[model samples]
Target: MTRFLARRTAMLVATMLVASFAIYGALYVSPGSPLSALTGNRPLPPEAKAQLEARYHLNEPFLVRYWHWLVSALHGDLGESIPLHENVSTLIGQRVGVTAGLVLLTSVIIVIAGVGLGILGALGKGLVDNGVLLASTVSAALPSFAAAVVLQFVVAVKLGWLPALGTGHGFADSLRHLLLPALALAATSVALVTRVTRAAVREETGREHVQTAVSRGLPWPSVVRRHVLRNAAIPITTVVGITIASLIALSAVVETAFGLNGLGAYLVQAAQNKDVAVVQGISLVLVLAFVLTNMLVDIAYAVLDPRLTLGGRAA
Candidate 1:
């Protein structure tokens, strides 16, 4: 178990390195210089341009600039934001929690609604299952942002059931505002969870252990509860873990639609304004969060299923 975990950890490190390199390289090569963005179409004097370039190390060789940025970023220095003139760290810190809260709420919805539906659909396996499968398919097809618009219009504007936007305030009022947006954000994720859980449950139901338990005169509910659901959840658990990691930079469009001030919103604003320092800091933090979340998810596998750890079985 320890060896397997160690090996997976090594692989994860390699993956992160490759991903970071790609992210950094792409950021550097992306068109439109921050200088141009800062100064706009008006041409700056040579001396002014030189000073600006020197301040941000734009005068350095590309590799040198990248390496310097990497090192400085490691020490919590993301250079100066040409536009905002504020510390990148502070800007990102101010916004990250909002996104974290949204993700948390979305995860709860996905787990509860998704898994609950999976269990129900799996137990019935006919009209109920088919209907859920169709709905899940639709949810999966729609992007979060588009879904947010649809939900906002139908639920908030048309139905007048919930508030249309914003976060923070009276718990009930804020929650009402959050409901549609969170559902929109979570819809695809819930679809994923439902599909995974349903497939797992379906497969587990046909396993020899399940048949044997059934043949022993156990109630179907008892058999499913005791034997199938836990084993079935293993694969779903993996995807759910991955989904959480994937949320760090996701939900920007949702934020825009619903007027939520989140990390995703800040990222879009930073990129649009060419706030280089803020962009770099936010990107680095997002990548690190994903890497750390993935690591935690991997560690959680062994905890969830004994078969994958401590010599129970090779997976």
Candidate 2:
């Protein structure tokens, strides 16, 4: 177990380092100069252009600049934001809290609604099962942006129950502001989870152990709780783990629509302003988050099924 954990930890670090390097390279080669954002349509003098290039190290070779950025990043210095003129790390630290809140709340809602509906629907086929299927299909068809617009209109604009946009003050206020966007962000994921869970549960129910439990005269509830759900959890866990990336993508649209000052919003803003430092820093953080979430899910697999080793050996 110690060896397994150490190996996973090493892989995590290496993966994050590679992801960071790729992000920096991508941003370096991306079209549109920060100078365009700086000077706009105004023509710049040769000296001014040279000064800008020198300041940003644009005059350096790609590999040289990349190495410098990577070294500084390893030392915990993400550098200054070109557009915002603030430390990139500081900006990310401030905004990541908001994105975390949104993701957490949305994840909770998705797990409960999706897993609950899936389990209940799988217990026996009837109207409930059909309804769950229909709902999941419909929800999955709606894009995040469209869902956010509809939610904002219904819950905030028309009903006037919640704030339509902006991050309000305090925890309670922030939750209210996040609800609409989070719901929109969670919709597709909930559908995905529901489908994955339902399929897993249904498959587990038909396994030989489930039949054996029934033949032993075990109660239906016990059979489901001890046999079906336990075995079904593996696939469901995979789906939930993989959904983190989708959630990140949706959060960008949701944040834009709701005007929340989260990491997603900051990324969009940075891209528009061609803020390379902010973009690279935020992208690296997001990739690390994705990697960490999958690592946790791998640990979760062992908890869910002790007989299955995370290192691929059967316990």
Best by TM-score: 2
User: In model 1, which range of ten residues has the least summed lDDT?
Assistant: 306-315
The Cα local distance difference test for each model comes to: 0.80, 0.87
Best by lDDT: 2
> Per-residue lDDT of 20-87 in model 2, one digit per residue for the tens?
87998888788978788778858899999999899989999988988899899888889888767789
201-296 in candidate 1: lDDT tens per residue?
A: 889999999999999999988999889997887787888888877766677878888999888888898888877667777777777778878777
Looking at candidate 1, what is the lDDT of residue 131?
A: 89
Off by over 4 Å in 1: 1-16, 170-174, 310-315
Positional deviation of residue 210's Cα in model 1 after best superposition, in angstroms: 1.3
Instruction: Give the clash count for model 1.
Output: 0
Question: What's the alpha carbon RMSD for model 2?
Answer: 1.9
